[model samples]
Target: MSTEHNDLTAANREAWDSKAKEYDAKPWQKKIASQVAEALNSHADWLGADWASASDQECHLLDYACGTGSVTRALSTHITHATGIDISSAMLSQYTSLLSSTHPSLVLKTSVADLCSPDPQPSISGPEFHNFDIAGVALGFHHFANPATCIANLASRLKKDGVLFIVDWLPNKIAPGEHIGHAHAHPDSHDHNHNHNHVKEEETEEWKKMKKTIKTNGFTEEDMRKIFEEAGFEEFGFVVLGEKFVLEMNGKKVEKTGFIAKGRKV
Candidate 1:
């Protein structure tokens, strides 16, 4: 890996490791987890025919960048086995704890692995990591230094006709001189706040440090489609959720519109 990419990976790992405990405790995070889980389950068709027809034991899932097992928990009832991998060991610990407590019957395992690396670890390159019926990353794409390479790496692990999906923020347009911030908002809540500059001046430093870990603010549908195609995937589908994810950053709420994109391995 280039020095720049290595630096990005290190920065993100450090940032997420430090915030893993707090991230797992956030109510908004839990709420968005439920929302994403519902969206994925309701739109199963988007995942492709392989996922729909596979028996529980045969339905293998790879939740890459799987922090706290959000995607795994979301599909716990549907699939019997899942493997989760993340760069942050702390995040993987949270995922392991949560999965054990809530879905003990489900066979979900997690490890600290960075598949996006130019040379993946030996354990990650084994047969067990390949031939997944479905692979997914939830709210973790923006942290990747090279999302296209990440997608292609994940795609190479899937069996033919396997599905790959991503749930992440849609591109947010910021006006000049406006700072990005999120406030508490939900689809059912009538009280809405659209302003993106409500964060207090004191929190700038914290937000700045956090922003350094993010490679991109968001992604557009066109961008997603092209990336998926270049990654050797077909049957592309994208859905923008009606609900907004309320994020707590530096004691301020940041509302973000989320979307789901999926494609089948060709």
Candidate 2:
């Protein structure tokens, strides 16, 4: 792992661990999480058909940066089996509770694996994921200090013709803006809003979270294509969501946030 990626893993762990306790209770988080997962499932209808045509069985999917396994739980209905990995133990603990309560037999599993660390992946202890059909990341990836390298590692883990479904905050629109000041105007401005104590300190410090990080890490669309191609991915495309295209300037309703990249390993 690169030193930069290591730093990101640390930051990501801090952010998620801080948010884990309140995550389920936050209505917005719950709604967004569910929507992202369901959108992925709809996308599967398009991508899954290709895998099905290739004779793939019930999908074996890995949820990367799976904070509290919300996406994992949401994905259970679409795939045969799912496994979640994160660097935050607190998030995984919540994930464990959610899995235990629902989808107990969905081949649901969780592990602590820092994608930016030099260490090997913690034991998954299962026959599945050996040749997983699909791999996914939700609102993650940008947290990687070296997202290009992270993508390479993830792509290498897939079976031939496997698909990688990536959903992340796009720097183009969702990047943090002058909205901090505007946000202060909201009627619900409590201590958490003013003190910045509730949210991760770094989140408030950054301008556009992923943009600066990606530039600092030297990652780009070309970098993604190169890594995926080198890892034997045969097809690739992307969907930009939220922000300008999905919403009007008036902030009525359009898209929510971020973009999704899908690549097929061949």
Candidate 3:
């Protein structure tokens, strides 16, 4: 990685570490976890014996960017064991605490390592991830310092035919400017009122630079499909899950939408 890339990764790691406590306290985490679990569980059931009936020894999940183990906790009944990896120590600390109490059935392992690490992901508390059947990165890709490379590395970690599931934000606007801050649209409940397709004409130079230095709003469906395909995943599909989440910002309603994408490693 370039010096600049390394610096950004360090910054993101620190930010998430500090926010670990506040993040676990948020009610939104529970809601997001529930929706994510439902999607994974249903997909597992539909995938039949390949995913649904496999024994704990036969199938394991790698929950990439699994802060606080939210997705793993929600997926308790769907899969057998899981190994969650992240860059934040404090976040992993919180993840361990929750797992011991709220999700004992998960048979989970936690580690603190980013995609850039060269050694086998060493867990301060658990074990390295290997030969997993399902991999998920939930509400976490936008934090990646280099998403494409990260996806490819993650693909390498999975066994053949293993599935990957990703859930995250996909904002429809590009509010360009230095530190313009992330923008999320708010529509009526369960409504997808804004166009999520890229609008290049509306972007300014500041926005272009920002895309390199910081993760903007998030990845679009088409953007994600291309990335997954590049990472050697086949049969790509993306779908909006649940409903529009309306939040109040400065007394106005700001709506955020969520989407999930799944693919199988070829």
User: How well does candidate 3 score on lDDT at residue 72?
Assistant: 77
The TM-score-based order of candidates, best leading, equals 1, 3, 2
Clashes of 2: 2
Q: Which segments of candidate 1 are over 4 A away from where they belong?
A: 52-57, 174-200, 204-206
Better of 2 and 3 by TM-score: 3
Overall local distance difference test of candidate 3: 0.66
Identify the runs in model 3 with alpha carbons over 4 angstroms from their true place. 46-49, 52-58, 116-128, 174-214, 246-253
Q: Which candidate, 1 or 2, would have the higher TM-score against the true structure?
A: 1
Worst 10 contiguous positions by lDDT, candidate 3: 178-187
Pairs with backbone N, CA or C atoms under 3 Å apart (clashes), candidate 1: 182-253, 182-254, 182-255, 183-253, 183-254, 183-255
- Show how many residue pairs clash in every candidate, following the order shown: 6, 2, 3
TM-score for each predicted model, relative to the true structure: 0.86, 0.70, 0.75
Every candidate's lDDT: 0.78, 0.59, 0.66
Shift of residue 103 alpha carbon in model 2, Å? 1.7
* Candidate 1 lDDT tens digits, 93-192: 9988878998887777777888767676776877888888899999888778778888998998889998899999765554332223222112112224
Assess the local accuracy of residue 172 in candidate 3 as a C-alpha lDDT between 0 and 100.
Answer: 46
